[model samples]
Target: MQHNLGVIGLGHWFGWLEKGVGEKGSLKLVKAVGTKPFEDKAKLLTGFGITKDRYYISDPDGKIPEEFFEGLDLVHISDPNKFHKAQAIESLEYGKRVIVEKTLAINEREFEEMKSFLKKKGMEDRIYLHLHYLHKQPTLALAREMPGLVAKYGKITSIEANFFEPVNEEDPRRTWLLAPENGGIFMDWVHTSEIIFRMTKCSFGGIKKASDFGVNTDYDSVNPTGVETVVEVSGSSYENGALATMRMAKGTEKALANKTLRIVFKSGFSVFACFPGHEAEFNNAGARGTLKILDAKGKEISSESLSGQNSSEIFISEILDFCDGKRVGLNLDEITEIFKSQWEYQRTAGTRRLITDRESIDAFLRNGASYTYCK
Candidate 1:
């Protein structure tokens, strides 16, 4: 059975979310809930989309009445951080699976409370997270192939990486990047999923760890000040003003290309085999073997290339997977746990309330405590 979805927050990225997700490809919109009442509801979302059945809520505290979520299967929440935990908890209680926006909550304290609420209601399993595109996160994509990639060459001795991109000057200017209660950069980046890749997925050997100061959002503001944060995870550091470095062999395709990358882990030696001046498009995503110890000296290691389905599609394919019998590996409990640990790390390092704070979500988390992967 296709899941009937109710897209609550219809904002700029609403279109992107509709296009890039679940059963929406075939199911009905079921309902659309926005912050405004039916009148302004349609107005705020003008020009984008507003189906007939989709209604609006004028007062910020309005609800769909009793049993409003009776038949809905899923609810995607893209509201501001301040309203997320509350709205999401309600949706889950009403029996709607949830995919909340980043940070999950304004503070770490709420992160715990919301999920705990669901666990107590026997709805924790139904509560899910749907986050937007995570920037600069190709790190784990590389790690997935580590086992096979390393087998042919040699054990990975050392790895290095540097990830940095200027804030979308235009996008943030129009969104939440400006508010502190909305959880400035630290809340969005450090306390959320972006850092999950660093915590559990990537494998690197770096000695120093550091975090950079957060830059003022009103960069164009006259006496601007920014938050400076330093955190060490997975052997790497974060520096705001300086270039990041990961000391692994530049021997792979996804590793740093522009900066210095030298990988010398038993595979003779490989230096960004896909560097622009070298191989082009096909060579772009797949790993390249610079020097493998497989054949005799002077023998160039063969370049491997392949592509097909993405994991998101695979993850989604498992949706009705639970309909009949449970399938293995279709779920991401371990992956989610790895991600939760990073959230805990962020809560400890920065001043914020975590998901563990909410009494309800705290119970929600306990249920998962034993569902870890067997591998």
Candidate 2:
């Protein structure tokens, strides 16, 4: 069955969805909404064989044309973070399945609003968060082997995950990243948070406390106030008392050798690393990466390297499942929990707060004033 897909944004990231949908052959890109001029839209849509009639220009008021939702089986939202909730809620209401870009909502309130809308319509399973990294070969391998490793070594005691990329002031994509409402590192780094949650199997013990530091600076006069260039977050997990730290930076002197995930158990440790060019390798055949395990004495116990595993396959598989009326991974509740924990982390930035009970977290989430941000 071919699912007719409509895209809400035509930015650079939309290319990934276009490529995947084209390759999968189970989905058709039929329509799109963008804020570009007609000539530009003609040029962009020509490549995809999408007619000008199917290409829509969004209004200044951010209203989607009624016609855009006419025949879409699914709508892929790659728009700005601020617009995600309304666009997604509208799509689901129109009876279209949704595939939203990462950081599903900018904050907990928006996430909760979307959750409430879905539950009211009983369409809770119709949306999927596009967390493609979790589908990578290295991550999958780690998830598969983690149980045995934990059984042998002991419980996880500490974790370190780093996702860093040099800021490109010249890139058009940098505009949204600089805005706090569109979400700086707080929204972007949710992928890492999801990875941590899945790695620990929702066993991070409920996030006991969190502290974050954001470095805002001007780069090439892009914006006078500048965007966050560096973000470092540290927190303690609830269950096993595991301490986790994640560092994400937009500006760095040198690119990182790899995006790394390291887990240290009570007795031994293991590390999984994925380099920048893995995606290209993944497309050609599969991405290559390393998984190394070491004993407490620092003696290497086992080391395995993987090659040629495409993570996009996971996205394709999930799309297929959605079309087939099957439930996909990363349900509403799970993603909401992730958003809640990350919000607490963001709210408590630059300070530490030990949340000893659920009541405090509930009270904080309930207070609308705490959710307000600079517009």
Residues 1-375 of candidate 1 have per-residue lDDT tens digits of: 566667666665455454435333544455676665566556544433555455545245534444346577767677666677777777766756666665457665676676466557766455555442222123233344445555655543433332222333343444554355555444434322332343234322222432323222233232112222222333222112222222111111221123212233445533221111112212344322221222324344543332333323333444334222244231234334434533443445444322222353323222212211110
Over 4 Å off in model 1, which ranges? 21-25, 36-49, 58-70, 131-143, 152-170, 173-175, 187-210, 214-306, 309-375
**How do the residues 100-177 of candidate 2 rate in per-residue lDDT, one tens digit apiece?**
888667877777777888888888789888875777666777777777877877767767666554444543345665
Model 1 score (lDDT): 0.41
Clashes in predicted model 2: 5
Best by lDDT: 2
